[model samples]
Target: MQLSFETDVEAFRAEFAAFLDEHLPRGAESLERPRSTAHIPEWARRWQRLLFDEGWLLPGNPPEFGGRDASLLQQYVHLEELARRRIYHSFNPQGLGIIAASLLSFGTEEQKHRWAVPVLRAEKTAALGMSEPGAGSDLASLRTRAVLEGDRFRVNGQKVWTSGAHDADFILTFVRTDPDAPKHKGISVLIIPTDTPGVTRRPFGSLIGPADLDFNEVFFENAEVPAENLVGELNQGWTVANGSLGHERTLLWLGFAERLEDLTQDFRPDGVLGRDRYATLVMDLQALRLMGSAALARAARGEQDVAALSVLKLFGSEAVQSATEAALETAGPDALAHPARTAPFNPMTLEDFYAGWFERYARSFSGTIAGGASEIQRTIIAERVLGLPRG
Candidate 1:
C-alpha cells in the first residue's frame, strides 16, 4: 500500500526543509556527533537552542514547550525530514525525549516549569536512572533503596547504564521507598541533582567502542534529596516509568525505517548471497514502512493499538539490525578492520558506506534492547494479541 501525506502536510514538509537548509549548511564544515553530553560544542548548543526558539524542536508539543502544537501529520513529516537528513534537534535524548516527556505527562506544574522547561530550552541536561546491575529487563526487581527523612530522602544504591549521567544536570532516578512492599510497589522517581553530595558518576563505554562515552554507572551513597523532588505520587513510580518508556517507544519506528532506507540506497549486490539478502532487506524495509504508516494513521484517529505498536517496535528494530549486519557481511574482510581506523560514520556519502558498516552493525544491537527488549515485546504480543497463556 502507498502512504502519502495530504497537500497541506506536503507544504509543511517543504517549509521545514527550507528551514533546515538555511540553518544546516552542507559545506566545508559539518558537526560531528558529540562524544558525550559534556563534550557538546558551543555550535551544537546554539543549534539546539535555535531549534527550540523556532518551535521546531518538538513539533507535537505546545509553543511554551518548544513546539507549535503541530498536527499529527505535521509531526510525522517533521520526523521524516529530520531522520532523512540525519539531524538531531536535541543531543540529549534521555533528557528531552524521555525525562521531559514524563514530566509533562505526570509532573506537577511546578516541576514542569522548574525541570522540564530548562531541558526543553537546552539549558539543562538529564539522564534516566534505571536499569541496575541486576535489573535490566525486569526493572521492577531493582534494589536501590531510598529512606525518607523528615524533609529529605537519603538514597544508597547503584544505577548502571545511566546514559550521559556524568555531565547531566540531574538524574531522573527510580528508587525503592519501601523494601517491605512488593517488587513493583513502594517505588518512586526522584529528580536527583548530579552535584548532590555522595553522588558519583563513572562514565563508561559500550559495545559501540571505548571512545563512545554514552553510558555511565552512577553510585548514590547517603545522597540526600529533597522530598519535594519526588515525581508523581509516592510508590507510584511504576506508572511514571511506564510513561517514560511509552514516550520513548512512540514514533521510534519512523527513525528505524528512515535509517534502514538510507542504508538500502547505498547497498550493492556482491554476489548471489548479497543479492538474496538485499532483496529480503528491501522487502522488510517496505513492510516496516507500511506498518509504521498504518500505526501513525491509527494514532491520528485517536486509536491505541498496543499490539500493533509492539509488533512495529519489535519488527522495525530487528529489521535495522538485519540490514546493517548484511551490509557488513557483504563488505567481507574489510569490515574486520578496527573501526577507529576506518572511515568516519556517514551514511550520506557512499565513500564511507561500507567503511562504516561495522560501526552501524555494532550499534544496531542496542536498538533491539533500548526502549524495551525484543523478548518483552514478543511476550506482550503473544499474551495480549494472540490471547496465549503466559507460561
Candidate 2:
C-alpha cells in the first residue's frame, strides 16, 4: 500500500519533536526497547503527563479526553517518531492504551469519566486480570468467581500474570458471574480497586533479581466491587476482553517494529554473520513494516482483517527476535557479560546498548505471548484468514 501524509502531519511531527526534546525526563538519553517500556519509565511518565496536559497523549481522542483528535496517519507518524527516537510515552500500557481505549467504545459516559479519563492522564492506573495459572492462552477458562450481593459483587479467585497489580489503582478483572452458564457466556468484567479489603498481591521474583512485579499474582478473598464498577453488560466480558486485546495486539508492536528497523540500520554485524546476515535482516524488517503499515492503515479506516493482523503479529514478532539474535551473534563473547533479563519496569541504557543483549532477546518473548500467543495467532490466520476448517 502507498502510504501518504498531509503537510499538517509534518507540522505535527515537528511540534512533537520540539516538545519531546524540551520535555524528556532526566536519565532518558538511552535507546529503549519495547520490554524496557512495557511498564513506562519514570521520565517517560513525566513526559506522558506533559503530553496529557497538552492534549497530545491519545492523539485520536477528543480534547475532553486529553487527545488532539489527530488522524490515524498523524498518530502513526507520532508513534513512528517515538520509536525512531526510542522515547517511551505510556504510564501503563493496559490502562492508557488497551483498557481506556476499549472503554471509549464499550463503556458508559460515567465509566469513561470515572476511569478512562484519569487513566489517560495518568491520574489513575489499572491492570488487566485475564490469565490464570491454568488459563494462559485459554483465557476464557478462568475460574475466578464473582457473586452479586446487594449492590456489589464479592469476588473470590486468583489471577496470575496480572501485571502491575502490586501498584495499579484498579484491576480490570474477569470473573465468572454465572457458573451455570457456558464458560465464555457466564464471564463478566469488573474494575476492582486494588485496595479492596480482601485483595492481596504477591510479586513474582526474577530468577536473577528485581523482577518487574508488573507481572503479578493477585488473590481476591471475597473482595467487594461496586456494581457501577462492572464494565459492559454482565456475562459479556468476552466481548470486552477481546476489545482490549485488539488494541494491544494492533498497536503495541508498532514501536517494536520501528525500533527493530532502526537497530538494523545501526547494526555493524561482523564475524560469521557479517553483511549477508545484515542484508537479510533489513529485507525481513522492511517486509514486516509493509505488512504492519497496511494493516494499521486498514485499522485506521475502521476495517478488520484478522488474518492480516495475525500476519503482522506473527511476522513482526519473529522478525524482531531474528534481529535480536543477529545482534547477539555480533556481540559474541561480550554477550556473556551482559544482563540476562530485562526488568519490566525499568528504563534501558544506551551507554552500552548492546551490553544487555539477552534482556532484549528474552523480552521479545512477551510480545509473542501477551495479547495472544504466537501459536494462537498462527491458528487465527489459518482458520480465519486462510479459510481453513478447525481441527
Candidate 3:
C-alpha cells in the first residue's frame, strides 16, 4: 500500500499543483460533493480542454492521445492531483476513465485513434451500454440484439440506468450477436452512434439533484452501426468489459473512500456523528483507503485482482452508506428539510458541498446498485477471490 511515487511523479505533482493554481476557474474548486450530479456546465468543458491542452488527460496513453505515456506513479499522481483540487477529472469521466481505458486495452488501433482520442479531447462523450431493464445483476440475460448484415449491424432492444446517454456522442453497447450460442458466449460489444436512426433516449424522473436527463432509458429499434464499430472480438465482450471495469473500480473506490473521509472530517459524535459511530466510520474509511491503495499498487505491478475489486466495490459503497446515515442522524430535525434549506440551518455545515447533504445521502445507495450490486459483488468474492463453491 506504499504510494510513494517515483521521482518523476514528485516533479509531476509540483507541476500539476502549479497548473491548478493558475488555470482553475473561479468557483470551480471542490465540486466532488456527494450525490452532486451536476455535470458539463460550459465552463467545466472549457476547463476540461485546459487540462487536455496541457497533456493532463490520460497519463498512460501515448502522447498523441492527450497523454504522456507516464509511469505508474505518474498516473497515480495524476488522479491524486485532481482529487486534491476537487476537480472533475474530465467533462465525461466515464468516457475518459472507463470506456477509454477499455478501448485503449482491447480496441483495434483504428478504434483508439477514432474514439479514444476524441473522448480525451472532450469533443465527444461515450456511455457504457451494459445493463438492461430485465438483466441488471444477471447480465448474461441481457436480450439486446445486434444482427450483422454485410458491413453493418442492426441493433434492437433497450438499455436502462444508462448514465449520460442523452448527452453522449456514442455508446459502447453490448448486444447479443449469437442467440443460438450460450447466453454469455453470444454477447458482443459495439460502438453505436447515439444519433443513429431508430435510437431514442428518454430521461428518467429523479428525486436526486441536478438534471434528470443525465440518466436515461435508451431504446434501439433496429438501430444500425458500421460493422467495423465492433469492439474486441465478437462474443468476447465479457472479457473486454473486465479491462474498463477493473480500472474504473480501482479509481472510483479510491474516490468514494476519500470523499467519505472529507464529509466526516471534524466529525464530533456529540454532534451529527455519534462518538463511537464516528470513530468506527473514520476507521472504516481508513480501511477502505488501504484496500484501494492495495488495489492500485497491484495494478501498478500489472496484476488486477477481480476479487479485490469486488471487495473494494462492496466495502467502499457500504462505507459511504454508513457515513451518509451518520450525517442524517446528526442533522436530526434538519435532515428532513430540503437540502438547499438545511444548509443554512445546520451549524455543522461549513462548505457548499453540504448544501444537498440529504440528497447526497439518499443517492449513496446508488453506489451499491450501480457497477454491480452488493450481492453480486459478494458472489464474485466467493467464487473468484475465495474459491468457494456456488450454491
Q: Give me the runs in candidate 2 sitting further than 4 Å from their true place.
A: 1-3, 27-45, 207-212, 269-272, 329-332, 339-355
C-alpha lDDT (0 to 100) for residue 229 of candidate 2: 88
What lDDT tens digits, residue by residue, belong to model 1 across residues 1-391? 4468889899989999999989973433443646675344456667778888888989889988888999988998998888777777777878888999999999999999999988888788899999999999899999889999999999999999988899899999999998999999999999999999999999988776787787999999999999999999999999999999999887988878877787667675564236788788779889998888898999988998888889988999999898878767767877666553455554223234224667778878888999999999999999989999989
Q: Give the TM-score of candidate 2.
A: 0.89
Q: Residues 119-207, candidate 3, lDDT per residue (tens digit)? A: 87776788888889898878889999999999999999999978888778889898999999987788899999888999998767666
TM-score of each: 0.93, 0.89, 0.89
| True-structure lDDT of candidate 1 | 0.84
lDDT of 2 by residue, 1-391 (tens): 4666678988998998898788766544423433321345444555677788897787888988878889877888888887777655674877887878888878889999988887887777788889999888998888999999999999999999887777788888899999999877899999888889999988675423475345788999979889988889989999998888877776666755775766665565654347888888778877877777778778888897777877878877777787777766777876556653443323432323334656666666776777788999889988988889998
Where does candidate 1 stray beyond 4 Å? 25-33, 37-39, 270-273, 337-355
Ranking by lDDT: 1, 3, 2
**Every model: Cα RMSD to truth:** 2.6, 3.7, 3.9
Between the candidate structures 2 and 3, which one is better when assessed by lDDT?
3
